[model samples]
Target: MVDKPKFNTALHEKDGVNQPESFSASSIANITKLRRKQPTATELVQGILNGNKTALSRAITLVESTNPSHLEKATNVINQCLPHANKSVRIGITGVPGVGKSTFIEAFGKHLTGTGRKVAVLAVDPSSSMSHGSILGDKTRMEELVKDENAYIRPSASGDTLGGVARKTREAIILCEACGFDTIIIETVGVGQSETAVHSMVDFFLLLKIAGAGDELQGIKRGIMEMADLIVINKADGDNIKKAKLAKTEFNRALHLFPAKNSGWQPKVTTCSAINHDGIADVWQIVSEYFEMAKGNHYFNAKRAEQNSYWLTETINEQLKSSFYTREGIAPLLEQYKKAVQNNELSPFAAAQFLLEKYFSK
Candidate 1:
């Protein structure tokens, strides 16, 4: 030490003082915790294949991530899981906001799991426009299902468009299937007049409706009704039973108005009280029958193959649109063009053309 002091910098340079550990115990613990939290894609895939819900949730988080790095890892995990998917029955459940879609799904999922099927539910919550924040309350709403070992519930924000949420859901289904969930349920909150995005991904589309005054037959949307393989009138308890039965009959009549579906499966209507768990078994029976018939007639695999093709095109369109809007120098120009169009300085079609040209130029 004395010889090192030959330089004589700042008088006494001493290595005599003892130093504390470079890392505290707490810090080291935290680092370990973080490392455990972020597992590798290979570990995640193995965990998922072994039916570990923790790994499933983590992989799904990666899939829903917007970070470029996370997305690449997500794609890797998805491709690996793709081979294990498609063995499950993907069911889409949608309804008006107040029609108890979550409640119905809970009851229906419980019924399914009771019949020896592993169920995974992907619930899409609407985002607030002002803050773009989601409630993510499906897990809270489905208390029993959340506790069921055989059932898994994942809630996702709908983000800006139904298409975006649907895409994430399609990916989530693959992950869940790879995890050995045989029955997949997708729940959407209040898809206005049409739920075409949800309809395209699921094998069976179940529309839930509640009994209301003059809102049954007169207020139904043709597009959504046409897509439904089964309509279940929920909350048919106490005083609502008669009204729900009437709604079911009206829905059945309305179903006949549309031309036959390509699946050659006639749409059916039933009533159930989700809160009271009445007629829940019947709903599953109908669903099971449809699956049986679909698989028997070879429509089941055909529909799934068709959906795969549809999602391929849908994904390409989504990526291209996202790329254009997120490119450099597009936001300010888009605002300027918006103002110009609003003032009638440029037509919307022309503004769109200009934006496309600018996007391509880069």
Candidate 2:
């Protein structure tokens, strides 16, 4: 052998330490400095497509970031990635706690992976951050699916968005698609009401239900039930098998009470045991059928186009609101105007006019 460096150096030897693997104080400083420089939008998009998970994560952070400095960069990143996005089928899954939403996703994701599809699970556990919230960990529940190379699990707190789905999840889905994931699943905590956020973004929306819940109708409102492309009865094995079947029948009947979600496809309700992996294939079949029908009718492309328009309008409205609120002296004027209105010194209309006049004066 050629003369080799000493192979017996101590683990803590600074000189012998691998530079890239170093977790030293200086390493963190270097990372901070690198982040501060902030890669260009094109470079960021390229890194995301090249499968740099860190870059992808950081890109999403930039999207969700509230910082004014990151906003322009985030917009550029989205614009750059838009052409490479919207190729994947986006699915939204929501259910009350104990309905095994994560467990079902795990089983379903494994089924998709078995078929050579790259699956990405973006679980939004809105209840995770609360002071007294129960079931704070959706990721922990998805243990088996988490280990698969073909699957990506990103468990995000719902944050200020109440539907257990991140406001930025739409952006996250685009990032996932650009990273080569074919199927993107968004899981939400079901608080009964319809999750307009989840419904608006996904091509297919699924609702999960459990058996023997006396307040079955109470748990899911009509508006949400009306939006479901499919309803799955999870935990269908063991003692609840019969109950699960019954629940499916009930849902099917209830589904008929509401009009069909789309002209070509009627929502179907199925049962599954995610723990035992029972009926998981059937669930996938139903989802595939829905996709086929939707795609065949050309509604798939149309829907995405409509969603894009919605996103643009919504983004513009938000930006306008932010600009108005943060317009230099607007806040102080509004404060003074609020006191004026309270004392009947000015009407709400007049106060608004005053603010508008001051805003446009500059």
Each candidate: how many clashes?
0, 0
lDDT string, candidate 2, 73-120, tens digits: 998888788778877888999888777888789989999999999898
Which 10-residue span in candidate 2 carries the lowest summed lDDT? 127-136
> Number of the top candidate by lDDT?
1
- Each candidate: what lDDT? 0.88, 0.82
Q: Candidate 2 versus the native: TM-score?
A: 0.82
1-362: candidate 1 lDDT, tens digit per residue = 35543565678667787878887999999988998877889999999999999999999999988775687899999999999888889999988788899888888888888888999999989887799898899999999999999999999998877532544888999999999999999887675845888888899999888897566964365777888899888889999998998888888888888999998999999999999999999988899899999999999999888989999998899889878878999999999999999999999999999999999999
lDDT of 2: 0.82
lDDT value, residue 1 of candidate 1: 38
Q: TM-scores for all candidates?
A: 0.88, 0.82
